[model samples]
Target: MPALDDLSLLIEAARRSGEIATSFTGKTAQRWDKPDDAGPVTEADLAVNAMLHQTLTAARPDYGWLSEESDDGTRRLGQRDLFIVDPIDGTRSFIEGSDTWSHSLAIARDGRITAAVVFLPMLDRLYAAAAGAGATLNGQSISVSDIATLPEATVLATKPVMEMQHWTKGDPGFKRAHRPSLAYRLGLVGQGRFDGMVTLRKSWEWDIAAGALIVTEAGGQCTDRTGQPLRFNNPDPRLNGVVAGGDAVHAALLSGLAQTQATP
Candidate 1:
């Protein structure tokens, strides 16, 4: 199928999943965490997972599946194309009544993402992208911020990671803040609302896959803090961390990350 065909499918499934998610937001739902302490998963997450699995699988059984709420089997490793998903990217935000949660979905072939869609139900905004095609918000095209440096740049990052201790040169003095949703944080960077986003903990593929593509397609860059490209559908679907921003800033940010992560 064409890239747009895959994109269309992702957008449809994301919107449908977003609708299902909205229904359970204000209502009560069962919630729990994995024995491994991965994070919380609510009834809404499972419901959306099932709906999206059915929606995508029924249309493309040959495609493999990788989902936050589903079992991670070895089957996906052999498929040429697969779906990477987070039923709801920000369960914490969603449970807290924050509107930043999202339904993040993407299609990856080989090791690269080809199509993606992120839907924020409460905000009524949809972000979508197809390989070699520009990104869009709702229906209009979007791009990363033009800001070329970090001084006073609006950034999304965990407090400690953004601290002066990590910056060897001195704190970049970013206008930093925390965003509960990883996907939404990335989406914000893609929308030019944030100059950059960073994290220093392990990041799941399902959490960053869609957002990575969206950020890149928006004329920004995304990769592990060590300056490595993110590849999906691997036996291990997690990354050490991610840093994303427009070209010049992204390069500079990586240098800071290198110093921060460097051993004393």
Candidate 2:
């Protein structure tokens, strides 16, 4: 099937996942931390994950599955095509009644994401992209900002990423901000709402897979902290870190990060 066809499949699945998630809103949904301090999960996340797994795998049985809420096994490693999914990208935000949580989904073929969707249902913001087909927000085309320098950039990141330890020559002086959902942060960058986003901590494939494609299709760059291209569905299912932005700003961020390592 074509990438766009797969993108359509993901779009519908994400919207339906949104519907399932909202049903848990305004009510107390069971929430608990995962093993090894992996963060929280709620009843809504499981519900949405079950629906997406059943529906999507039914439509494409030949494909493999890798979902945040599902058990990780080597079965997916044997397949050429895989579904990478995050039922809810911001469970803490959802538990706190924030409307910014999102459903992140992607189709990866041979370690490359071919179709991707990051849907913020509460905000009614749907970001979709097919490899080489560009990106969209609610069916309208979207792209990253033209800002070429970090000092003039606005970035989405946690406060710790802005500390002096992360930069060699001191702060880069870009406006820094935070968003609970890593997927949403990437989508906002693709939509030109922010010039870039960075996270130096190891990241999960489900959290960054869809947004990585969205940023790339939107004429931006999405890579690890070392400026290496992102490849999904690895045996480990994790990345060194993430740094995404328009080309120039991406380069600047990587350069500074490399300097930090060389310092002290």
- The lDDT of each candidate is 0.87, 0.92
TM-score of model 2 (CA atoms): 0.96
Quality of model 2 by C-alpha lDDT: 0.92
Clashes of each: 0, 0
User: Number of the top candidate by TM-score?
Assistant: 2
In the range 97-158, model 2's lDDT, one tens digit per residue, is 99989999999999999999999989999999999899999999999999989889999989
Worst 10 residues of 2 by lDDT: 255-264
Q: For model 1, name the residue pairs that clash.
A: none
Q: Where does model 2 exceed 4 Å of error?
A: 259-264
Superposing all C-alpha atoms, what RMSD in Å does each candidate have to the true structure?
A: 2.2, 2.2
Model 1 root-mean-square deviation: 2.2
